[model samples]
Target chain A: MKSLDFFVYLFIMAGVTYLIRVLPFVIFKGKITNTFVKSFLFYVPYAVLGAMTFPAILFSTGNYAASAAGLAVACVLAFREKSLLTVAIFACAAALIVNLIAMAIQ
Target chain B: MKYFKKGLHDGIPIALGYVSVSFTFGLQAAGYGMYWWQAVLISLTNLTSAGQFAGLDIMVRGAGFWIEMACAQLTINLRYSLMSLSLSQKADKSLRGVHRWITGFGITDEIFAVAMGSNKDVSRHYMYGLILLPIIGWTLGTLLGAVAGQVLPEVIRNSLGIAIYGMFLAIIIPPSKKNHAVLKVVIIAALMSCVFKWLPLLSNVSSGFVIIICTVAAAAVGAVFFPVKEDSQ
Candidate 1:
């Protein structure tokens, strides 16, 4: 992209991004009355993250063994309520180890 | 000054997470035919993982324009609106307009979660900390990844690409362990995603669309079936 075009694109993109974040607060100030709506909103982040993370650990690369190993490690760590850093490291380590072992066998 | 200090303290882990995630983005961009600087520039301007991923998809396809960029970014970042709204309630009652503006810029998922989850009213200083710390981490990660792309071994970089998914699992699994509702939502989402990916008619949909559909469907189901007990809200 041209320098001017790129900058202009960045400006517009930033503006729109800021608006998306800022508008809800400005418009909905003090108006979140419905209990179900509030509850749903409260849970949306966890729900959204869960949805993104699920198949990621189970079906990555269409390889069942590697993905299952990763999921198993993650579940074990999570069940222990390990720190986020520890859990992340262990899960990735599990996947990498599985892949490397598979390669060695081949 | 206080805000700056607070940002540093709360931002450390976030910064760490950003570095790890953005490094993968850097490596991917390099692999996908972007110049090193281009990858860094995207990280600097966007500073969002999902938005950057979508932007890359559009850029690689050569089908996106400024308008599409705007729409794609807005759609991916819609969750921030809710985060910020919840944050506004958590913020100090006496906060001025300027503080709101400055703090709003830092309202990321991790930062917002940390701030909202805090027991005390979130101070402007801490909010400032939330913003600056992650930016530093994210920016540095992008720069390092861009530079490392040419130097790092392929095996190492490939392994790092899987780290983001690992982080995602880290975030999901713990919450699900304690909360049965969360566990159900995750299971339902996985089943739906598998169906969409496996079914002949829907197998061709993009990953982004799969995420969107699964999230909305799972959340709607959760809302209906496990309506938050009346007193929690």
Candidate 2:
């Protein structure tokens, strides 16, 4: 893509993303009162992160067994209330180890 | 300054996760023949992971797809609106005016999650401090990946790909363990996500739309079936 075209596309992408993020702060300056709305908003973070993680994480490592191992390790650590950095590091390490084992088997 | 420093400290894990994820993105952008600076620019301006990848795909497809790019970003990032709305409830006086705009620009999924998980209301300085290292890590990782031009072993690269999702799990799982409502929402969302991914016709929907549909459905289920106390939220 030409430099001009890149800038245009980049601006469009950035502009749209920014607007989605900023609009709520603009429109809802005061606290919301509705029970259903509050409940829904309260759950949004977990639901979004949950949906984003599964299925996608399965394919992330490109090796199903390794990815599964990573997911399992992560779940175990997280369920144990491990810190985020510790869980993440262990998960990656699990995937790397599983991948290496699979390579040796192959 | 206390909150600012606390925010910076809390941001360390997030910054570490971003570096690995953005490095993969940088490699992809380089593969498409983008300059290192170009990849860095995208990471700087748009801190979104899935949105940036989708936008980069559309950009490479052609300049005529600016409209498509916008649509994709809007759909993929619509969750941020929900997150921002939720966060507005927790915002203190400091997160107002120009500060809102700056913080909003930095509201990636991880940042929002981290901010929401904090013990108290968010302030502008806290948000600023929270986002600082991750932004630099994201952009710097992209620059390193793009400039290095494919030297990493595939196994290590693939292993690192799971890092961000691991972080995501770390964020949600503890909360779910504490709250049955959160657990239900997470389960519902994950099952729906699987349906969207593996079902024949549904699998054809773009990832951005899938995420929106799954999140809204799951969150609505939680809202209706397990309404949280207004004060608890």
- In TM-score terms, which candidate is top? 2
Query: A1-106 in candidate 2: lDDT tens per residue?
Result: 8999999988888888889999897678898888999899888889999999988999988799999999999999999988888999999999999999988999
What are the candidates' individual DockQ scores? 0.48, 0.82
Model 1 C-alpha lDDT per residue in residues B65-132, reported as the tens digit of each score:
87888788777777777667766655675444766765676676677766654557777777776678
List residue ranges in candidate 1 displaced over 4 A.
A58-67, B1-11, B30-35, B57-64, B86-96, B109-123, B203-206, B230-233
Instruction: Superpose all Cα atoms of candidate 2 onto the true structure and report the RMSD in Å to 1 decimal.
Output: 1.3
User: How far out, in Å, is residue B147 in model 1?
Assistant: 2.6
Model 1 residue pairs with clashes: B3-B125, B7-B129
Cα displacement (Å) at residue A1, model 1: 2.8
How close is every model to the real structure, measured as TM-score? Answer: 0.82, 0.97
User: What TM-score should be assigned to candidate 2?
Assistant: 0.97
Tell me the TM-score of candidate 1's A chain: 0.79
Where's the lowest-lDDT run of ten residues in candidate 1 chain B? Answer: B154-163
Top lDDT prediction, candidate number: 2
TM-score of chain B of 2: 0.95
